[model samples]
Structures are given as structure tokens and as C-alpha cells.
Target chain A: MNPLLEIRNLSFSYEGSKSLVFEALDLSVREGEFLLVKGPSGSGKSTLLRLICRLNPPLGGTILFQGSDITAIAPARLRRSLCYVAQIPQMIDASVEENLLLPFSFAANSSKSPPSREELRAMLRKFYLEEVEPAQSAMKLSVGQKQRLAIMRALLQDPLLLLLDEPTSALDQESAAMVFSIMERLNIEEGKTLITVTHADYKPVKKRPLNYMLDNRRLNLLP
Target chain B: MNRIIDISLAQLFLALLFILIAQISSFIYHLGLNRDITIGTIRTFAQLFLMGYVLTFILKSSNLWLVLLVFFVMVLSAMFIVKGRVREKQIPYFIPTFLTMLISYFATALFVSGVIVGTAPWWDPRYFLPAGGMVIGNSMSALAIALERLFRDLREQRELVEMKLALGANYREASDELFRKAVSAGMIPSINAMMGVGLVFIPGMMSGQILAGTDPLIAIRYQIVVMLMLVGSTAVTSVVVMLIVRRRCFGSGEEVLLR
Candidate 1:
């Protein structure tokens, strides 16, 4: 079974900061693996996720996606295939419907049709956004609703691999539980690869997820 | 050709007395503009007089090379202003800015010369220098606004762009909104000037033509041509600069080259 993603000797530092966020790091994920990364704030946990998707190019080293150098893949294609959801969801100053359909408008994703209205209503309803209209401004949504929308937007693209940064950090316990359940289904039942970065110890409720602790710019497996 | 009367040095000096109105007003208001006014007056006298002698020699010789050299220098000075004034700290824009000015300034210059004012040699200093100056100067201002807005928007909205990229947008797609805004901002000045031209104000070019004894109708025609030319060049200049700068600011792999 080939690895879905691989990082080789990755070394990186912020533009101004001298200290390396991640140095000489390496890791790999199998096609259906559910991997959870745990670390304190400023541990480069989020940076690691971004690196996987080639958001911030590593100063030194190579990333491989599906046996090809990650740099070789077109950025739009790479992003569409491996969607990333940030910790603080940022919404365009437009309606939720437009935001939801945003990815489908991209050249990479344009070939695919947007999710149908019924599907959208179902997704929104599942996330407790029942009262929110499709044309409601995404900016006016609560933080939790925005997070759900961001996640749903990514799902709309039908990504093969998903990298989520603290997906439920802003949610109430009930919302967080709902999001985690959805993530579990996507990882377990749907067989999609998932890599999640979080400060909390979030164990996968359904499938046994591999836990890794990042320290001193290295990833260590935890049994 | 009608020979025009020239203002004598004494008349010019007497005209200078009009400065007392501003000097007196500044004194009464305590506007602190006396120093600025003095320095500006002196600098205007010195620069224009120097430029007058230089231009007279260049015009007499009709040296195309010298004319082009001066034009090149003008372009350089324009880029220098953009470099210092544009607040973007990201990608090295000196070359892109230089390229933008070069394409825009030359395109407008050639259009005015080859198409509009058909000089015998086509690079006639009399037509090329002044026309190119207006095109280049106005285009420079347009590019300044375009480039400044582009970088500022990108810097301030990095996350928005990144999020777009994350959602699978190419650089052009990701920056569509900012790009449109910058281009529009660049063009708005000339557009607004076009709206207000001839009605609210007599533009300097038209007044200069009229003062030089050209018929008012003929001056108005020239003004209209120049106004249209300015708006056209500004649009072309802003678009070219934005296109080149857009490529420089965003990398081939869809990574933002801001750093």
C-alpha cells in the first residue's frame, strides 16, 4: 500500500523569525489513514499541515503526493485534491450560497457541478444552520456556523485527502461532537484520508486514529 | 504660420509679482506656506529655465537619440517615484515597475506619434517629447495607484487570498476582485477628469494652446484629443502594469510571492 502523502527532511522558518518552525522533519500517511497531530501552541503543528498542501513552501526538502513530487503537481489541483480548513474560518464578504459554491467556480473545480440545493439544505441542517437562509451573508454567521460552512465548503469539492487545522476549536461541545462525528464518517465509512492538527487530545470516535506528538520539530508516534 | 509675440523678460518678471497675493494671504493666515512658496517659486524658475535651454538645444538639433535618451530618463524617474511611493515590501518590483512604465509610455508615445500626430520623421522631438511626456507622466500616476492598491490589498488580505488558494483557485482567479479594484482605482482619476474637462475647468494644455494664439476651437479639438489620449493611455498603462506585477506577485505554483 503506497503512502498518500510523504514529507522528506522538511526545514522551514517564518520570513522574519530566525527560529525554525519545523526542521529536517519526515512523515508519511497511508491512503485511508486517520492521523491526529497533537502539540502545544507554536509547535508548528498548523505549519506542518500547510506544508503538506504546499501552502508555505519548505525552505529545504521535498513533499510527495501520490508518488509524485508535490511541487510537480499544479497548485490548484493539489489544493482541490487535498483541501485544507484553517483554524479560524475566513468567509468571503458574500452570501453563504456563493461561499459554498466558491470552490466550484475555481478552474480546478469548475468541471464539477455544485452540490444541489437539497444536499446543501441537508448539510446546513445537519450543522444546526436550519434558520440560516442560503442567501444570508456568510459574514453574519456565528463562529461555529462559519466553521461548519468552511468544512462543508471543502467537502463540496470532494477532496481525496483533507487537512483540518483545529476544526472544532471554536465550536460548543454539541457542535464539536457533531463535527467530529462527521469527520469520523468521512474517514472511516467513506475511506478518505484525514490529517487533523489540534491542541486538544481528540481521539477518533469510530476508527482507531494514529496519534502523533510534534516536539522540537519532529513527529513521534504514540501507541 | 503666424508669428506669435513672446513675453519679454521684464514682462515675465512683472507677472511674477502676482506671487504677492499668495504671500500676503499666507502672511495673514499664518499658513506657514511662505517658505514652501519661496522654495517652490525658486525651484520652478531654476528647473524650467534649465529645461528651457536644454529643450531649445534638443529641438534645434532634432536629434532623435537625444530625445529618446531624455524619454528613457523620464521613464526611469517615473519608476523611481513608484518604487519609493509604493508601500509594498513584497516582491522586487523595480523591474516589473520599470517594464510596466516602459510598455505603457512607449505604447502611448508611439500611438500619438505614428497615429495621431504623424510627424515627418515620426520621432520628432517637437511632437514626441511633449506628447510622450504627457502620456508617460499621466500613465506613471495611473500605474502608481494600480500598483500601490494591488500590493496593499494583497498585504492586508493575505488570508483571504490564501483561503482562496486553499479552495483551489489559481492566482488569477484568487486575485480577481483585488485586481479589478486596483485597475478601477487607477482609471478613476482620468475618468473623473474626463467628466469634468472643458466644462468645469480649462485644462493647462488647452489654455497653453489658446495663449500661444491658436484658435479656441482648434485648441478645444487638441484638448479633446489629448484628453481622450490620456484616458486611453492610463487604462493601457494600468492594465499592463497590473498584469506584469500580478505575475511577479504570485508564483507559478500558485504560491503568493509576497515575501
Candidate 2:
């Protein structure tokens, strides 16, 4: 079977530097695979993810998704299918509901609209985010709450690929477990592909996930 | 009480009317600031009263030097406002504002008085001073918006702007969205005035001319000229300010101004 996502001969360097971070690196993920990437700080792990989302471009090499070059794809369409959840989410100055609905405002997702009111409440209830006060400002939410809100925003897009960069970094242990459990359910139960980069060796409740580590400017299997 | 000079009730009441107009302007923003209202009223009374007495003395003496001095004072005060508000350590904030205001308002006022209204001396107190004040006031506001936005855009979006450059967007394309936002913000108040004129409220210049016993038709014609000048001056000043400021804002490479 064809890989769901593929990176071939990817090489990059910061501007004004005669060094390569990931030289001639190749990786592939199958459908519904849970890949956890481990790396030390500044190992180009974050840069690799950013390049996958097209936030930054690789100096050389192509990133292909579903047999097509993602770099050549239109930005709006690529962003719709492949959502990048940043380590620190940037919320526009708006309400919680408004932020959740922001992705729908894009032309590609507008047809999806939003789930019905009941569906929205049900979805929020799963994450314990009850809509008790719709008019309250989103800035008032705690960091953990904002992170969850960012995840909800990504889920709202109905994206085929999820690139989560340290989603559980700021959460307490309990919150981290809840988030990981939800991610596992999405991967195994719902059959969505998830590529998460984390420092921890987290074991999912549903599916046993594959692991990779970034060391010596190369991605290698952990096991 | 040297400050307590003879003033008629009708003059005081007309002054109070303008004060009230300024006071009620906060309704649009829901900023029901009664203190702001009272302070604004007192300020308007003091300023207009001083100008009235000072100009009366100048008109009676008909001294050209005194009138020029008053114009100089206005320009200096305008420079102070721009410098304080912009507060840029790198650029001389006052120079851009002074040059912009002088070129825009002075040129328009000269054209209006010399060619159109045909006032005697072309710098007549009855014509040139008030016209210059109106044009300069609007230009100062537009410059404030443009300068504030240029500095803020540099500070806030350093990463995303750099990302745009990586994505094959040129310097022009990378900055175009931000430049458009800044220009739109600079143009908003004037656009609102255009939309609301003769519907929600009459502008101050037309009202003042009408109250001064000029024909309403002539007042409105002059008001139209002033409004058009305001739009022209705002557009010209913002573009010019952005062009001059953009040089200092960008570095040699993809690096942007941050700090």
C-alpha cells in the first residue's frame, strides 16, 4: 500500500550557515499509524514538522502527501487537509466559539459549516468544555484550556492529517493522559493518521504506537 | 483679573454649543466619560477664546508679522504632538510630520486663497489661518496612524513575515498585506466622515462658516473642497511616510526590524 505521507531526501540548513540539520532523510507513514518523534531541543524536530506543514520550506527535497507534492499544492487547500497545531497556539482576539469556528470561515471548510448546536455541545462535553458562557472572552482561558481549544479548532477543520507539535508539554499529568487517550481513540477507533512529537515515552490506551528519535541529524527507529 | 475680559452671552453660548458637540461625540464608542466631556468643554472655551482675542488684536493692527508668528506657533505645537505620539528613537518623528503637514496644508491653502477665493495678501487672517488649521489637523492624525502602524507591524510579525519571504513572496508582497492594513486604518476616520456627512452630522467647518454669516451654499462648497483636500492629504502623506519609514524598517536580507 502507498504511504499516507512521505518525505524523501529532505535536507535543510539555517540561512548563513554551512551545516545541514536533516541531510537526505527519508520517512514514511502508513494509514492510521501513530508515530511519536523524539528529539532533543534544537534537533530540527520542530523545523521538520514546520516544513511538513509548509510553515517553512526545506532547502532541498520534496514532501509528498498521498502521491502529490505538498509544496506545490495551494496553501489554503493544503492547510485544510494538513493542520499544524503549534507548540504555543496563537488565538486571534476573539471568543472561544469564534476561535472554534474560525477554520470554517475559510472557503474550503465553509461548506462543512460547523456541527449542529447539539453536536457542538456534545463535542465540547467530551473535553469538559461546557458552553456555559458563550460571550466570555477566550483570553480568559488558562493555557491548558487554550491548548485544548486549539485542538478543538483543528478537529473542527476535519483534517485528514494532524501534525501536533508538543501538544501535552504544558499540561498536568492528568490532563496529558486525557489528551493522549483522546488522540489514541482518534487514531485507532476513528482511523485518522497522527504524527506527534514529544519528549515523553507515552503508551496509548488503544493502539501501540511506533516511535522514532531524531539524533545525529538523522531520524531512527526507537525500538 | 486680567484674564476676565468682556465677553457677550451670545458668544459664550455659541462656544458652549461647540463644546456640547465635542462632549457628545463619545456616544459612538459607548465611552460615557462625563469627566472627558467637562474637560473638553473647558478646553474648547479657553482655546477658542484666546484665539478670538489674539486674532482680534492682529486684525485691528493688520500686522503681517504677528499673523505669521501665530502660524509658526501652530506648526510648532503640531510638531510636539507628532513627536510625543510617535516616540521613535531612530527617526526624527517631527521632521516627517512637519514636512508632510507643511507641503499638504500650505499648498492647498495657498491654492484656495490665491486662485479660488482671491483673498487680499493671499495670507489673509480671515482665510489662510483657519484653512491651514483644518488641513494640518487632519494630516497630523493620518501621520500618527501611519507611523504607529509601521513600527507596530515591524515589532509584531517578524516570524510570519520572514516565512512569507521563504515562500517565494518578494519584499513588496511580504509587506503588502501589512501596508494595506496600515493605510486602511489611516483612512478610516475620513471615510466615516464621508459616509456620515449630511446624514448623521454636519462637519465642523461647514457649520462654523454658516454660523459666521456666510451663505450656506458657499459654506458647503468650501466644506466639499476641505473634505476632498483632507482625503488627498491623508493618502499622499501615508504613502510618503511609509516609503521613507520602510527603508529603516527592513534589513539587508530576510531579517526584519525588531525592537
State how far residue A23 of model 2 sits from its true place (Å). Answer: 1.9
TM-score of each: 0.93, 0.59
In candidate 1, the second chain superimposes onto the true chain B with a TM-score of 0.87
Candidate 2 per-residue C-alpha lDDT over B1-259 given as tens digits, one digit per residue, 9 for 90 to 100:
1133455888768767665665577665667876888986778779988988988887887777887778778867876787788788754456656766667666777777766778888888777788778867887787778788877876687554543333333445556767888877888888788788878998998987776677888888988888877787678877877766665565433235444
Instruction: Give the per-residue lDDT digits (tens) of candidate 1, residues B77-166.
Output: 888877777866667778867876777777777778767777778888877878888887787788888888998898888888989999
Off by over 4 Å in 2: A130-135, B1-144, B147-151, B154-181, B188-226, B232-259
TM-score of chain A of each: 0.94, 0.94
The residue-by-residue lDDT of candidate 2 on A1-223, one tens digit each, is 9998899999998766888999988899888888899999989887788788666667888889888898666655676677778777656567777767766654556567677667766777766577434456778887777777777778777778888889888888877787787788878777888888887659766578888988888889877
Question: Looking at candidate 2, what is the lDDT of residue A214?
Answer: 89
Q: Model 2: clashing residue pairs?
A: none
Alpha-carbon local distance difference test for all models: 0.85, 0.74
Worst 10 residues of 1 chain B by lDDT: B250-259
